[model samples]
Target: MTPTTAFKVLTGEQMAALEKDGSFAGAPVDLADGYIHLSTFEQLTETVDKHFAGHDDLHVVEVDLEALGDAVKWEESRGGQLFPHLYGPLTLDVVVAYGPLHRDGTGQVQRPITG
Candidate 1:
């Protein structure tokens, strides 16, 4: 089932760019793959550990999928799980909230609050 929202993980530069430019083309891997990768709330932890490990100044941004219309696609990846892929550049307007990566006491990364 598709969730109403998804999350994108960004490095400090990328986060700053998005904030300043009001949009982001994609990360290098996203550019190579032809889409922006997004992780569901449930998939956040492992996505960080596996792909973003050792990366500094990471941030997590909450995205409103409904606002993007058809741009968001759910495709099978990583053990056959459906991940959200944005076919177009990510605009800041669709990002309802964002903040530096933070983990709860349980060690799970927390999503930034909306509003």
Candidate 2:
């Protein structure tokens, strides 16, 4: 598996761990059901716009994995642990992150997928 894909899957698992441990700050967000919320970064951006800034006293930002360089930054920015969930039943080595979907029948993570 490519380094990129491996990381994506790792990110998903990390998210699950965080959920299970209930360490997320702010809201009690439960994301440990082993489901990947697939949406284009573009779609995520649109949703952010429609919500209106300061509408709910919460802010959202869509960041490219390419820009993430540290764990502290990721945890602080996303408000939760993020892990890659390999969409299909396949070898972990083959997973790659294709935006909100598997691009090359593989999945990758840009965040911690485990605690």
Candidate 3:
């Protein structure tokens, strides 16, 4: 994935719920924060390492920002970097692709196939 292709990390249950509901309002932390958190490809590994360390059945969802329109906002976050935050519900229509998250030999999450 490249920085141009934003992505969201989700738990299995969250993904399942999203699939069933047709739209994802927000995850637990996202609801608490009042916005959905999204990371660029460059930020993925660190985001997972910091927030999803022991998580199982994780999924990396590639999203089409254009489909989200103005609902997506880029704001300053960790390390003063601007991260994409969604102020509205995430519809399945914006999802380009998604699959289970795996780990590499170093115990870090493997990069998702973007092309």
Which predicted model would earn the best TM-score? 1
Full candidate order by lDDT, most accurate first: 1, 3, 2
Q: How close is every model to the real structure, measured as TM-score? A: 0.96, 0.22, 0.88
Per-residue lDDT of candidate 3, residues 5-110 (tens digit): 6888989998898789989988889999999999987788899999998888899888888778788889999999899999998888888888889768886666
TM-score for candidate 3, residues paired by index: 0.88
For lDDT, candidate 1 versus 2, the one ahead is 1
Each model's lDDT comes to 0.93, 0.28, 0.85
lDDT of 2 by residue, 1-115 (tens): 2123223211343434434653322222224433233223323333334432333322221223323223212111133434333222222222222222122233221232222
lDDT of 1 at 114: 48
Which TM-score value belongs to model 1?
0.96
Clash count (model 1, backbone only): 0
Name the candidate that leads on lDDT.
Answer: 1
Q: What's the distance in Å from true for residue 3, model 1?
A: 0.9
For model 1, state the Cα shift of residue 63 in Å.
0.4
**Candidate 1, residues 75-113: lDDT per residue as tens digits?**
999999999999999999999899999999998999987
